[model samples]
Target chain A: MTVTCPDLSVEIAGLHLQNPVMSASGTFGYGVEYEPYLDLSQLGAIVTKAVTLEPREGNPQPRVRETPAGMLNAIGLQNPGAEVFIDDKLPALQRFGVPVIVNISGRSVEEFARLAEMLSIDGVDALEVNISCPNVQEEGMTFGVDCDMTGRLTEAVCAATDLPVIVKLSPNVTDITVIARAAEQAGADALSLINTLLGMSIDVERRLPHLGNVTGGLSGPAVRPVAVRMIYEVARAVDLPLIGMGGVMNAGDALELILAGATGVAVGTANFVEPAAMHQVIDGIAAYCRRHDVARIADLVGAVAADQA
Target chain B: MPRATAILRHREEVVSGHYLLTLDCPEVAKAAQPGQFVHLRIGDGTDPLLRRPFSILLAQPETGEVQILVRTVGRGTGIIATHDEGVAYDLLGPLGNGWEAPAGGEDVVLVAGGIGVAPLIFFADGLRLMERQPYVRSIFGAANQEALVCWTEFAARCDEFTAVTEDGSAGETGLVTDVLAPELERDRPQHVYACGPDGMLAAVARICRDAGVPCYVSMEQWMGCGVGACLGCAVPASAGGYVRVCADGPVFDATEIDWERMKRR
Candidate 1:
């Protein structure tokens, strides 16, 4: 009846992870917030909240609302900016056992590069480029949809730091493969696909929008199918290591991303619904491995049959 | 508190919209106080990502089982409700402080609205076991008689039980607080424990404040990370600050909470 920790460890972009159980960027704030509830040491790595070149207060109140199968959020990348993150947050994450991946957003290519440069601290293990923020008028959605812009931004960020760079893609695109390929061609060490989908909710009684921002990115279980498809498409288009996410609540969901070509998976909206879901998923993966008699979970990656090619 | 390695033993549909999930954790059950909750991961298949927070409805020490009563309000709970029994679920809990009963010679008042009764039942059990002969009284309000779940279990424990229905379909007419007002005058309990919809708790707080009775109110919030990561469940306090419902409290002193700010128009 003795239970030993499973070797669900993974290496993404040279960053060693204890396991593949990671909390998504927006859902997990700076890796310091959830410390009181559960031990941070049990996680693979902590992805800080999406940071920018300067501090952002985020969208107005009612930033989130419950939808049919998921939820919509217009947080507007609320963070203390890149300088503050490195000065205050990054050092704190270093004390924990796992690596810290800083998720950064920007208004322009130089902004991203500047933020990336600042994040090149001693403790920061990697950078997750958040190119899907829709509220920021200048850089977010605009840079993510176009392959050329994505390439330019990716190259700029990759050049600015020695830390592994993970380009987190937007699901609001028709051809997600184009952006994935562009990030790979631009020297991105890894890829994380399927950020929140663009969506909104309305209050019929009040004749107004449910959220203060009027529009937000849809997340949670509702976006799982779209995320799965996008991850699968990106998997086919790129050869780099992929971290797939979007409504991943269980080991089977995490496995779906791996089969779709993801090397790792992050749980986002599920964190809000259940705080201990990440640990559950990690343990669930181990149980699945034991049941299937598989020695390693990494073997499940890209195991799905290629249909078109 | 002993950290028992608990596993999700089973998930079963109890009432129409509610689920009864059992976690096999002997230590947690032994250490768990009434009103504390367990944060749970819902699905084995992964689609909805997040752990839903459910009140620790019952914990059986001998059975090594802890029960969570969940009313499915979103995808996360729905996912959990549909799970096949015996599937393992990750759990982190016996979390958030619970209501501690008053000292000897003090009467205990229990107020519940609908599923809010889940935690109060445990509170009653603790009181009865302590041999306090705690002057137990319960007033519950529900949308209708059918929604008034587990009334008999609590009624049998309490010295007196009053049920209220908004639509007048069951028990007395009008809100449960209306029934509580007359009962409070008659029982004159020194302390009160309540859980229910936001409006009901606020009303209970207001009543307790005016009556000079101390009350403990369990609040609910739209949680992001139930363990306090996402900062989604922030409840304003009377002390000019915000306390996280998942961390600082799913339980708080009625008089200490900012009732004005909690009421969403």
Candidate 2:
């Protein structure tokens, strides 16, 4: 009898992934920056930072602050605009031999639609519609808060692009499941749950807010439980594949999301702590599969027992 | 660059709240340039989850050692200050762009304040390694004499060194900028490299601009990934838009930065 390798491949909607681990958007800059440290081809996919309609300067100085067990960032969607991203970043990203998922954000439904249409080039594999940028003052988390707006924006983006669309949901709402179901109904191919929760810190000595933007998105191990909880609920609510992320630092954290019903896992804050963290998560998952005698990594998704629940 | 666990060869409190940590890591030291920094993981646990970035104060590639001058500003640095010798730190670096020295024999001035003196020491050391020594002048300032660090080291590398304190406890009684203004007027240096508080950098940039002297400043921001990916270390460019300090530069031409916007933070 031949012992075959465990299959780590996953398919989110129509996009086939070699593995389930990919770098979270904003954390991995165009997949070109981390090439010196880790092989980008080893991961499942690369999620580019949120590209806007025009070049944005983002927020003022002090855009990030480290909190206990995590960090808060108010990097207000700074990018070289969609055109520059396509002209400059996309060409380099295409060379990595991995699927490049472009993350796009806008102030309005028309802007999101326009971005989706513009980014529908050959080199781009998919589009991660980011309706949950907490740092931006206007239009970022606005679409994500309301169910109707989320559905409308998702529908507009999906109609604009032929590429598989993944709607990234914000956790700042009252109920995440409502928005998750709305995105699914709006024809989103898949969903990415729990984009950092909004939070702020005060510098008592200076009597000022820690982040330039009064509030920032909270990420890291501190938000892991919240991500898992949101993923668990949304996974049960929607039939669409879910890309789960919050503060995944290692393989164990990745597995937690997978077992909680995430079809794919994204490494965000961990990339800051360890540049090659996504590779380690990929290897750890493989090791776990062999230890448990699991034939395929896909079998581990939503495998949480009722008693464990 | 490769990530390695470097042993803490030396740890000393050089000032009231500042600690100098020396690590024995061959891989990092060999690749480190003057203005590049190391991202250090303070402890084994994930309480303070993110790695704190520190400018490489000294890099001795031959001896496989690198030094980081850390000021105890917060809980993360506080934790780092308490560690003794023999502690191992997970470091990923010599990340970001370093200071590019001007052609040999040109006059060079280095300005530093408080903990900002860290990277300048490395820059001054690199100058010494050159065949021709530039007319090096260094101006360092602190709240008082006790806060001043590495003046002796600066003296060895620099042809002339000026130390300033707010309380008249050191070389001069006023700001380092006070010395810089007159010096630029007397004989403008070809290049000025500065790493200090935002206020100091802004002042230096203005003086250099008025004097028609090129200035390079190492910016400090709350960084996420020491690489370009995070965009956490965004600094407004004078021309327009923002640039990542971690990627575009920790060291940037003075004219490139929007000094007014930078000082607001």
The RMSD (Cα, Å) of candidate 2 is: 1.5
Displacement of residue A214 (Cα, Å) in model 2 is 1.0
- The lowest-lDDT stretch of 10 consecutive residues in candidate 1 chain B is B42-51
Clashes of each: 9, 0
lDDT of 1 by residue, A1-309 (tens): 322444577878888787787889888887776665567888888888888888776554456677766777776776667778878878889888788888999889999999899889788889999887776677788989999999999999999999999999998888898889999999999998788888988878778887666898888878888888888888778888889898886888888888887888998887665556788888898887777766666777788887665
CA lDDT of A121 in candidate 2?
90
**For model 1, what is the error of residue A18's alpha carbon versus the real structure, in angstroms, after optimal superposition?**
6.8
Q: Give the per-residue lDDT of model 2 (tens digit) for A1-309.
A: 222578999999798899999989998888888888898888899999889998888888788899989999998888899999989999998777888899999989999999999999999999999989888877879999999999999999999999999999999999999999999999999999789999999999889998888899999999999999999999899999999998998889999999999999999989988888999999999888887887888998988885664
So what's the TM-score on candidate 2?
A: 0.97
Docking class of 2: high
| Per-residue lDDT of candidate 2, residues B46-138 (tens digit) | 788888889999999899999999989889998988998999999888888999977789898999998889999999999988888788999
Considering only chain B, report the TM-score of each candidate against the true chain B: 0.92, 0.97
